[model samples]
Target chain A: MESEKAKILPFYVLIDVSASMSGDKLDQANRIMPQVVDALAEAPILADKVRFCVIDFGSDAQVRLPLCDVLDQHSSLPSLTIRGATSYAAAFRLLRSEIEVNVKQLKADGYLVHRPAVFFISDGEPTDPEHEWRTAFQDLTAGFPTYPNFVPCGVDSANPRTLATLIHPASGPKQMQMYLMEKGQNPADAIAAIAEILISSMLASGQSMAQGSSGMILPAKQDLPAGISAHSSDDFV
Target chain B: MAAPEEGPVRPVPEGKWQGYVEPFVVGDPGRAAAGVVPLPDESAWDRKDTVLDAFALREGRARIVEVRAASVRGLAHRAYGKVRQDEYGFRRTANGRYLVVCVADGVSSGELSHKAAMIAAKGGARWLAGLLDRTEPADLPWGQFIRGVAVMIERNGRKLLRGRDDLDAEKCDVREVAQRLATTVLYAVIDLHAVDGTHAVHVVTVGDTSAWVLREGGRWEPQEAVKNDGAEVFSPTVHALPLPPATEPVPVRTTVRAGEALVLMTDGIGDPLGQGTGPVGRFLADVWERPPASGLEFAGQIGFARKSFDDDRTVVAVWPVNGR
Candidate 1:
């Protein structure tokens, strides 16, 4: 028991930086990212086990920060700017490849990696054909070793039903969540809320993982700020 | 009837358990000057077995009960994760008129949160106990009270890290180094002798860990409810020691006569209880209503089929034996 050290709980934030998320949405993402990172950094036990990754998806994908342990992360997360089109396939595919490499790396480093959580934030539907993005989702979420707990957060003009499919979790430790950003609120505040929820959700899940429970146990949808919350999932308890 | 209590029992602690332990923040002499002592040994942390130690204090009416155990998940994961980041302490004033109960939850992300929790709980209990023994301030001085504790922890934390230079409070580098050992605190100062015969319980909270009182008629009132996220407690604006510019503590006052119980707990149990619906809800209700007979019995129920959540759960409870 004295020898048992808590495993690392990795979190990935995937942003869709298509043209639609250009103005306030993208700006808000840049402004609020440091707060999110700071919140995670402020936690004692969580900072120790939780590693963070920020990935951007548009016409192509960008690995802003490869998997870096929050404990060792001294700087803020890389901010995302506007890009071509919302290419879900490019993001998921890149994530799939990254997971294989990163998970292995963390394990090689002697830290038991708990199932990771991927927060997929997007606005509009995929610019790519549905068939391609859907196929990418399958490959990224279903595999031999495992898939991450995917939480798809759809903001302004994004289709909730389609986003639901992206939230399929590969393991019990993973939980399914879909947040719909509400309209009418200040866009900046809304974007900040999104970052807050993601950080909060990740911290909660990471804590559950550290304690040795199956995986992340997120807050109920009702717990979220109004206008954004967990869309009903068969996985919801 | 509950299953017969079974476990290899450790001896009940005598005198100050904290005095024997060194603060993990042993690196800086200044931080060491502040009193952030670490545990004496690893065995002090509960492993597979439940730790239910009731030490009859010489100073006050409330019998101090410490309830801790390896979370079910902690036990299942080959004991990989250290037990939850919950820590509690009790100290009776030298005047023997007050018993201070303190619980601190280490910020999960903070690498040394467990140490923070330990320091907050013990440091607070001892500080308040000393305060009560000397003078009782008219106003609780919530901010100043916690500042003293954090000052000690940071002073000690810096020492533990072996600071290369003399400390500069205004410097971000020094603050960040000390802030590494962050934690949230919820505490209470219970008057051994009541105000005109009504027991007064003063509760204060910084982060999520909470305090509640249970009445004879099965009345349950919480001093603090679970926040939606860390915003209320975790924000830079809010008060947490080791971190600079600590926020004012949330304060609550309630009276408890005989035949009543007071409970202090961290979020591991609060999340389920705050939701208050399913099996976990029922279990919480039962605990308050029937009150398990022993620490092991109480601990068994805490770890019982909590379903999905696995964060450490700690509950420190006190039931007055007789009317003052």
Candidate 2:
């Protein structure tokens, strides 16, 4: 008999590819994806535990990079291109279905799947009606077995209250975190910070597993980039 | 000198039992092949532990049981140049009526947790041994015993902090100091007295350190369910030592017949064992049907390489010696 399947942590990076993110912001986004992937590639032990995925959302949402073993793939992530509009509803709906399908497939493959973590980076609020996006967000979160740890990172022109609302587990100990750029801080720098957050969180979370703990460990508040401020949903409450 | 005359070679029997098969590595060896570069501790006065510590043999037929134990640095720790955070110890009462064994894994976040593991395994085992000598097993107050050990850890931890020149020990918050030296423990006591030729073993555990009974003919039976089996989301949150208020050790009681062995280990070995049906468990079950010829061999068996299961591995096995 062989050993039981090793545990895995699935991480989804959702980049808003709307018109608002056109120009320098989109370039920064494209540049960071490869850097983040390369960072994980360098640390094979941490890479072994992480399953990386890239999702792009505009007027519609699509799986730009399917959930995969970043270490095994050894392929470059697709560059994000500007698309229709910022549709939070599309992102959440697609995320819900993707998580449901991905977690099921991972389980079938004999890997012990951990709760998925979705890092949502946006420069603007949802283009759809408040109720429509909220319904989609609720579907992505509430009463779902494989619901994700939603980390919403809001940059230039992005509404803090809206990003706060996007946080899953709105009022619990395991509540999701929100990050925003400080006033006048360059959005490109914020993108770099997001890259840092993504890589650090992946390493920290993987290290936790290596240490025999299975929790998703975020980087400390002090470790956040200078231009970025972290908050829980409570600030909005 | 004249050579002796050569004799005719006899054909070996088909399907006959062969000699010992050494434990082999599986999957990626990772950075373990690069070898170790010792990591320096922040406090220079505090020296790091040896990377590997395995007794060739620590067997004693005290009353009815024979004990064998070993502790080894994990490949991940070795690759990272970190000291082995796992420790194990065994003690026998003066009257030789009982034997106590302890295994502890220092929580990784705590820099000084390696010392905590040492205290828990060695200090805790010694304390438990004395307690057994004074009190009857049935009358033992387990909750009080655990709390007493917690107090012992705090006292020893304070002494460790005070020894450091960098920090003011008295100014440090007591709770934070305790947290910095957290470790999980599993303690087992074998009742030397035999009831119908079977010895009773009492096990108390906090966190994920576990115990199993390996029966004759290669059957591995986990004493209790510690890992969450078949759960979609596995939380690594463990309840470690210097435990919260009202925390009680998870207790398990079982009998070990002669030829059967009771084994205690940390999650480094338990996570890989998973319900004792995997390759790791199968290998262990096959190799440990009888006590290893030496503790070096026992440590080798405990440190078998399996993919993605690298963590500090420590084990203490108590086998009941027949007719002892």
Candidate 3:
């Protein structure tokens, strides 16, 4: 029998907009928005193959862009407006719904899909309520045979333990990276880097999908940025 | 399965379609993956048949998993008659999942270079899929799979050359035929079985297309040695080479763990950014360090680099999260 031919990858960018990200954090993401869109346009593969979405969470979670291709509607990407507490649980629940709808749509259209990716960017702990974030995360992952790729990026202000839990079960040696965005550093530069990494990861995921491959591996600690540091899961809470 | 057909697999258009013309701007601000070109409905080209329509249909799934893909006649002008080739697919198997992603730049030098690229893409996808299905995930004979894929391509090329009636000596020569269809294939297979709790990543690759991983602390590092930055000699672009003889095979593998992200991409990422580990590496590092932005934001960054760097780029990321 002819094996399946297409793989669908859904990328959700979940940004934290708590009060802590008020200044440079928010500004950097805004400045680098156009550049990120431009990168996808130039790459025909990403331009053609990937569907993208954005969700911003602070007091609550909001969908910036539902599953859409950046190559087609670059200008439509939602603008970021920061204000409120970090409700990570609400954000995860929202992401779960978005992923389900998009995955179904993709399958109905005859595309083979891999698991969706949730890129969680945060600068603080969950101030909304305890265990809510954990419960939502668990419920979302419960249905899948393998866990979806949920990546957590921690800004300097973020609580390491909270970030550790975001990357859960895989904590300790497998904890997420802590991005040390020093004071005065251009937020644009960080945004640009984030964009590049997302695009690169999306592209890489597409490449791996085509090859019938599973998850790609992470780089060694030495290979990453100098300021970024990895702490054991115990270091968090 | 059915026997090989004697005629052309699919019909080629007799003449160019009169599609709306848009400037092939490398770094234009408003370009998106698959949006309407904001014109009067009547003025717009048949939206259904356009490349953007196909993209819209598949974008969601394409973003999440490994899947076969193709893009043609959009970015460049028709005068050059360029047809972009892209194929991506992923399958989770018994031993592991196989991922294949590649962009074939048909030798612009040949009469039917574009055709060759399309064929390579279709044939390659079919061949890889078949091989993955046949091989149990537990017995992922990497070398054997690579050889089988190459053989399938050669075999398909011969069939196409023999069947095409429009081609004469210049285009029909088998050796020249394969040469004209030159493409760079970058494939990676991840063995989840190899994931023994600790971080272990196995990646196999050929040509300049790259494989990388992002660890804790948001550090982006290369998984393969496509270039030697140690000597300060950076050859960032993936080097596409002639496919080795059917008897020989090339494949590399690595193992990865939890809390890590894996990435793979085509060489179209371009120079300066593509040349060394620094630009792409740093770019990814920053992305990992920061919070997750929207896909539009991600595309904006990639589009900026493409315009500034001037190359067709593609990147993919895979991160393993804790189940509970």
Candidate 4:
């Protein structure tokens, strides 16, 4: 064993694969997923610190990519297809359990793991009852020491107000943010921009860890891509 | 573990180009590539400033203690073309009975935090030495002295940017500038002329800079509270100096028994070394069992790279010679 433990930052790219996202939105996401993986894989320092995962949720949620060091492998990202209705409760419940297991495994492997960050991209409202999803979201976030930074990007018919509720801690320091596509913006363009934001945030966060001052470094509001407006969880509150 | 690896491991041929050990990475070797250029800031004018520095001295009455200290700009800072934000300073009291060493890590967020680190390390050590010279240990007011140090940092830090265009000096809050120029600092005062073989070290820390006693057989016994070892997650937040004048820092007094060394360092070393049982701790404990051949070698040890731990690393170590 290399006895020397590596500091690792785990990032999950959670995407919605509901029937409404069947066309250009889903195609654009599939195309950009590889690019995101490749970009992180190319940077050795960033890759060493970042463990990337992809989870897709429709009526159910499935782990498209297991969390792994980006530097270790180069494989095609599992394609996300149209599934059933958007179930935020299912996504939240799966994420809650996966993160716990993944974080524990990383620690056992002799790595110092920082809080996981989830980049959730959704294109529709949750079909599940507000109570069911809200309960799951609360369990996934509130009072959880290893709760991930929940960044939800709303596109097309996705509700900006509904997405804002997903922000973990929901207040204070505002590590997690919600981004919405402008009313007239193209969904494909919005998906591509979210990809860009995800990459930018990961690179920035990894760079901070490399500097020995570690934390989740979110993109500043001004840095967000055009057509994507960043909102504060405080605004929703 | 087998006796700690012996003196100064030579740099691998591939990494020798950089002089320091090319840090070891778990994945692709190229992950050590250069970082984004840091945008021009207030400290940009001094970009060519020294990135690596060291200090050493041997002093005592009945027992001699060798002191070696070094500071290096972390790879992340180097990648961004930023200057090293960590600093270390030392002073021998006027009476020559005590040695004061201070190490500081400038909070990376502040534009001129490196300057703050310099002031705290150099000025804090100098100020403490001056106070030690005039005041008896029994009468020295520890709490008031630390609180005053915070005030002094605020005054000196403001003075540093006196002529800068951005500052409205008259209206600026003292605590605000202190917060902007925040840095974590650790001070270790050694009783050099101790009658007993054990040299007593009085340590005061603001923020995360820490100290430990490296006992015989390479044990890193932490001098302060160790909170992260068994915790579920690591809290990155730290309390830094230039704190409110009302906050009086506590001090940890420990004795370095014969054959033991006292080590004071910034989180650069502490975070990775964690309880000192892992690779970093084991590597350091073995190599540092005794003093290195020279200050340069000791500096090399301080800069050892492990993946994900790139930060400005600074350490001051004191070892009391038993028979000298």
Put down candidate 4 lDDT per residue, B113-137, tens digits, no spaces.
7877888888888988998998755
For candidate 4, write residues A1-237 as lDDT tens digits. 233345778898889999999889999899766777678655655764778788899999998888876555564468889899999999998988889999988887766778888889999999999999999999999888899988898999998789998876566764677888989999989999899888888888876765445667778888989988888787764
Task: Order the candidates by TM-score, highest first.
Answer: 4, 2, 1, 3
Better of 2 and 3 by TM-score: 2
The CA lDDT at B261 in model 1 is 70
Q: Write the per-residue lDDT of candidate 3 for residues A1-237, one digit (tens) a residue.
A: 111112345667888888878877787666544665776565554455566788899888999878876656353867899869999899988888777777766655434455566667777778866777788888776664434567677665666566766663364432333333344445445544555555556655544432224343344445544444444445556
lDDT of predicted model 4: 0.76
Error of 2 at B123 (Å): 1.9
Off by over 4 Å in 3: A1-5, A145-147, A168-192, A210-226, A230-237, B1-324
Q: Candidate 3: which docking quality band? A: incorrect
Of 2 and 3, the candidate ranking higher by lDDT? 2
Q: Point out the worst 10-residue segment of candidate 4 chain A by lDDT.
A: A1-10
Q: Candidate 3 chain B, which ten residues in sequence have the lowest lDDT sum?
A: B49-58
Write down the TM-score of every candidate.
Answer: 0.50, 0.81, 0.42, 0.85
Per-prediction DockQ comes to: 0.04, 0.35, 0.01, 0.40
Put down candidate 2 lDDT per residue, B1-324, tens digits, no spaces. Answer: 110122444566998754565755544543332333434434533443433332311236333555667787776565455668888888888887888889999887677778888888998899889888889876678888888777777777777788577566667665666567878888888887788988888998887889999887767788877576667676666667765434555568898987788989988788877777766677788777766666667777787766555678888887776652
Better of 1 and 3 by TM-score: 1
Cα TM-score of candidate 4: 0.85
- Which tens-of-lDDT digit does each residue in A1-237 have in candidate 1? 011112567778898888888888898877655776677545544554567788998899999978875445374468688888889899999998888888776655433466778888888898889899999999987663547778888888788778877776633444576777776565556667788788787767654555324366667766787666666455344
Model 3 TM-score (2 dp): 0.42
Q: Share of real contacts kept by model 4?
A: 0.40
Q: Is candidate 3 or 4 superior in TM-score?
A: 4
lDDT to native, each model: 0.63, 0.77, 0.50, 0.76
